[model samples]
Target chain A: MIDKPFNNKAWLFVLPVFFLVAISAIIPLMTVVNYSIQDTFGNNQYFYVGTEWYTEVLGSSRFHDALGRNLLFSGIILLIEIPLGIFIALSMPRKGFWVPVCLILMALPLLIPWNVVGTIWQVFGRADIGLLGRVLTGLGVDYNYATNWLDAWITIIVMDVWHWTSLVVLLCYSGLVAIPEAYYQAARIDGASKWKVFRYIQLPKMQRVLLIAVLLRFMDSFMIYTEPFVLTGGGPGNSTTFLSIDLVNMAIGQFDLGPAAAMSIIYFLIILLLSWVFYTVMSNFGADAPNKEVG
Target chain B: MAQISLDKLAHSYVAKPQTDADFALKQIDYVWQDGGAYALLGPSGCGKTTLLNIISGLLTPSKGHIRFDDDDVTLRSPEQRNIAQVFQFPVIYDTMTVEQNLAFPLVNRGVARSEIDRRVADMLDTLDLKDKARQRARGLSADEKQKISLGRGLVRYDVNAILFDEPLTVIDPHMKWQLRTKLKQLHEQFGHTMIYVTHDQTEALTFADKVVVMYEGEVVQIGTPEELFDEPAHTFVGYFIGSPGMNVLPCEVDKNIVHMAGAKFTLNKGYADLVGKLEIGIRPEFIDVKSAAEANGAGVAIQVTAVENIGRHKIVRGTVNGYAIDVLTDEDQSIPSDAYAVFNTSRFNVYQNSHLVRAHS
Candidate 1:
């Protein structure tokens, strides 16, 4: 049988979104591309530099340090948040009045603006006035996020976890709720232990959502800017200076357009490459993971 | 292997159930014999699943005692009770192979590794899943997953009973019959007390030696398939059992004579002082279609409306005195316009207020 004729008119429905994305993302990306390849002193004057800035940004230890810090931060946050989020979701009430209460409380951190969260934590981590700092200091610990490198890193990591763990919790909670009651009943009849039920049933059912959680947390933490900028300001000797903060310092702070533009392009490509790698490895792992059947 | 007994069992989802309507299952005291295959047959919301859950210890009845061979297991968990249940939909562990899924319960019970392997292998062969033994359960079709579910229940030899809650609901029609026969064979081989629940009459009648019919949270009748068809205990049973169900007509009863739709029908037994809403029930198979002359001024003259040829038998639909009645006739039986519908008095059942009323001796 002849296949139905292709519907060319479907393009009309897609034109609006295509034009919107072109204007909002593609055009700006092209401008960044243009700036990255050229050297501009001022007043629209341009000179073709041809990969000189790429080499400079790549060779700079400052860019390297910031990239390393971003990777460490993303790694630490993912390790903490994914498991903790799943733990909290598992402990949460499956039904009754407390369900909405727990959900709304978990969502509160996510609803706060990033800058507001950073500002709140910035004041909250002050040793003299903040409850956390005062408690730690009163307990005879020399804790000061404003001056100590380790303190700064700890405070920033804690703040990031506080701000983003809710997203993971919500995703996992939805996955847990979508599981049918029959699986648990069957498990009970099978005399399965709690861990076995979780290992074989709950964990497999939550895989898709857990993948989304990992990807979102990774991308968000890697590109995290406003929170750290407001809280630590990438200070305490650049201990918490992530990649985005470093890129901003290059582009707007120093006004080093050529190097900053090149750094920005490299940053975008790094994120893209890493995310693609993550997607490929994870999707393949998911496919190869036995017992990933959904009921 | 164990005789299951439910003593004064009742359940309600409500915190404080003051009325019978609030209860999901009314007071039920019944005993299921050891090594018997029984079916709990009912329409939706009739609490068959609720009763099964109570027996399996998945649910605790509001007031009841569940006994297995003289042992009180009322407060025991399903694991402790040693019962196996297959749900309406297949509940196979997706991450495991078919063999692993079958061996799960046995392994959980700390059964020896060799024994578990032997049991799993035997179950795989029995379920015709030997080829798919090492295949992940996630990719199997619904019927195959259900077969795995059944195999999981059957793999454990120590289970007291196996409860199936509409296990064939997701199975395709052809596969349903095959799996059903396999289940019957398994029951014969193992001698496990099995309680199968379903709303489908054919599945109930074919699979069960004795069918327990439930309606509106109460057990209406519990009898063999032949008994259920021949003599229903309530109007709901009459309506819910057969294909077209039993034909129940309103009647005015006076001793042995019953007047209905301007015609009189005599009963084999007399009902003296019978009160309340009176009605007569008769199965379609027992109704006879006769020519006007052959009827010999007996039976009710009905206006024939429709004749449905149902392969094996023809159903004659007609109206007598504005009351509709159905007569099951042979395939070659010709339907005449002027036909009288006759009811075999020996097979007639009298109902008073929706319940079967026995005639005075």
Candidate 2:
């Protein structure tokens, strides 16, 4: 098909957005790209270091450990949150006075700032003065998030789940309510069991929204930083050191700008590639499957 | 398969209905025979859907009972009632193929795999969906999706009655006739007790053995389409049923004579002691336009206003003593400026307060 000729005047409407994106994204990205390819010293002197920082970051055991931990954490959170959110949303009342009440309660966790959430969990997991730690310790369990690597990981994961699961619940709830009442009535008249109704009717209707929820949760969990940083501080022997935490420690703490910049680009590319894969696979699912004749 | 009956059935959305207007469906008592096709005909918000929902056991009536055969199923759930309902909008399992959607009801009821396959295959052919049988229901057009919905209702052989609440409302005008004909064919072949609800008179007249005409939450009359058109029980029915509906004009009843628009006509039955607002109703087809001299003693004089030729016939509209009157005539029949409108006395119906007046003992 022949393409329509472009209008030069259409560029005027897009110039503001292009300028905003350049200032907000491309300029910072180019700075990262520039740093990734060069080495800088204290006297405003620099040396071109091509592919060295990239190779160093790629071969580092620290990066590998952090990447593995990040993947594991995101996977675990998704496994817990998606189903739990759906369950909570399904159990919620479909209408009347309780709807607003339930919605407000579900939105409470999301309204809390990320660092405040981390700080709250940090204190809450302390065995010395925190209520949860005191109760667990009182229950005769050895629990201390400050010094124990496994305990620190557990606390951070729990904190992440508590902070973000509501987002999934809200999205799923909107999807559930959007379904017309006729579907349920039809299912009932058709003699469909509760499980069949949920599996076939409700789930399919909620697919689009669930796709959005899954994508948002995946991206957010993959790049999770503030909460874990505050709660675990990449401490308890690096057990809770996720990818973002390691990047921040390298770039900010140790001032290893070259390796950190290379790692940042790699991180961005990984997120972009994974998101594309997720979008394509999910959108193609149950869409235009080859027609097979029955009988 | 089953005779459905509603006994003094009434429903209201409000918890405590204090007035008759509060009831979505006023008291209704009727029985639909087994293996009969009936239509609940009414304008929107006339309780046609409310009555359908009540019969399908989707909504529990605030008062009275519903029975299938000899069993009182008023409190039973929809599944327990064994009823099928096709909504105005098509409802199908979007993720499933056409075959799967048709088989859903049978699968839910735990029918044998062979039986489900056979029924699904049959429904696919019957709905003319054999070519699209394997396609996902989400990809089908509105009419095709609706056909799938209808197939789901028909796939279950054990259903007591199939209730349709304007099932063809969303179908295209051209496809509507085809689906309606298919529905009639299915009803005749299967001998199922089908109650189709619609506001369209043509649909009601064509698909139903009996049309129950409802007005403002109450059933005005229940009869064959011919009976409803010929003898409307209430003035609302006269106004609602026919195109260019019956003209109901204010009149004065005196002994055996009815005086209307400064003209006098004799009644077949006398109502000497009738004490209410009197009116006479006649269909436009029963009125003839004649010259003033020829209709001197037989008709009332009218000032002609407009004549509309509607392909098959012409509708002559005029004023009889400042009241609008319509007369349906052959297309070749020419109207005059000052014409006398003559009523067929045999087809004349008198109403006392919006209800037909029948002679008493």
Candidate 3:
């Protein structure tokens, strides 16, 4: 074993980051912890009620419904966005004058603010004045997002796909371009089919970038609030309410600070746990495989 | 297997090449015999790689007809041409095991499963990778990864030719020799036409049956290693082939007599009215160094500068009348403080405008 030099002064350099994180993250988290374990009445009078809010929040069927909705939304968006992004990236021009044009077009949707995207889709999907709504109506289809929970879910899902698949495309594109030209030349010499080339070369090369894209899309979709709140306002009957939306409704809408605080902690832990699982599984992918035929 | 021929091959990166300067590879016609080993040897930016790429069907020549035996394959793709190429760096499918990588080409061509397994196993034994056959290719060292690349190419039995583009550049020195020998043995066993490209003279001389030397986007000479050493078609070949290379000195030729740097000598063969930048080329091994008095006014006086003792021989570095010259002698041979250098007439060559001039016997 190599001997490492010991230095107490190293901690001094870490002090700045430690203080910044405490102020920005730790302090707020501690306040939430404090609120979750106490009961607050009018004029800031409080009484200790340890673990009561946690039990109440965990046991509620409404919280379970919101959690289910959040997982379902995140799952649906991930399934649609990941493969769609890779397909679009593959179809994009790899060379010539059209490359920059295609890149700028892909980046356009990502530049729009989430609230703006939600508002635009809200107006665009209206039955009377919106083009999409009128087109569906002209086609003799019953379409109304304001009254139907399915319509609200479809509108929000489509809007999110439009605004976010481009990010995945950009990430995958960068990964694809970074591969050396030699690999392609060798593949051609080997008489590999287009699909085999993608399977053996392109997909493996893009694994790291795809991991980042999946995690980002999962976390963002799970914590979705601004866009859906603007578009469906947690739906006609909580059909589109996610964890963050539910947490906001519980804390600010109903002023149930204790229960909301408990729910927030659980939400943070879920995101953290899921991201860690994703990172571990994705990074270990193909690193260790059974000694079997590649096919 | 089929013999390959290039008819007036040339290439230019420019869309419309206006002049010869625009061409990266000048027009040339040559034939590589079936199952022959040929090396494209040259310095960097000399179009050797470009020529190899053209032959491998990775790049199409601007003006050329490439024929395998009789069929013109000029515009054919690499796959259509049935070619295999090992690149400078290892290009292995990271997800596949060593055996899978070796079997990939055979599988793609729809070879029988038993045949693929047999060939892959044979290749694994040949490459000394049998122990790692089931391990992922991504975890191998650079040289081992390169071996997999070679195995992939060699596993296929029906490829027209195997092209190697400095495939040993990434290998360590000790391993380079071993791999080179392994490649030569494989060539002999398989008898597949191979074209190896390298800038190193040792690699070219050792690997190829015929070495095609290129300079400034043009092939200057194509000959066996001994022929390249004995009779260089151009001055660049003589300068490029040897350890210290050949020493070229400006000389005036008249009939059979040659006037050198402040000295004169008679030649056995006569040259007929040679003109335009005449010089005499002689390898360092052919030059003799002796004491000035023993020369008896037959040789030119040279100022001995430095002597390097290389285990088997000593190289005498000096200048004769402001022209640099090198002489090779036995290590035990004592260099006289005042040295006189004589060129062996039988081994000397005459060059006019950098091209060798034929002698009138």
DockQ of 2: 0.54
For candidate 3, the per-residue lDDT at A34 reads 93
lDDT (Cα, tens digit) per residue for candidate 3, span A1-295: 9899999999999999999999999999999999999998869999999999989989999989999999999999999999999999989888999999999999999999999999999999999999999999999989999889999999999999999999999999998998888899999988899999999999999999999999999999999998779977888788888889989988999999999999999999999999999999998888675443343
- Please state the CAPRI-style docking class of candidate 1: acceptable
Q: Which stretches of candidate 3 lie over 4 Å from their true place?
A: A1-4, A289-295, B294-296, B304-317, B327-337
List of clashing residue pairs for candidate 2: none
Q: What is the DockQ of each candidate?
A: 0.47, 0.54, 0.48
lDDT of 1 by residue, B1-361 (tens): 6999999999999999999999999999999999999999999999999999999999999998999999999999999998899999999887777888999999898999998988888988888988777778888899999998888888888789999999999999999999999999999999999999999999999999999999989999999999898889999999899978899999899888888778887776888777899889989999889988888987888889999999989999999889999899999988777899887878888899999988886
lDDT of 2 by residue, B54-119 (tens): 999899999999999999999999999988889999999988888889988888888999989998
Top candidate, metric lDDT: 3
* Per-model i-RMS: 5.3, 2.7, 3.4
TM-score of each: 0.95, 0.95, 0.94
- In terms of TM-score, how similar is model 3 to the real structure? 0.94
How does chain A of every candidate compare to the true chain A by TM-score?
A: 0.93, 0.95, 0.96
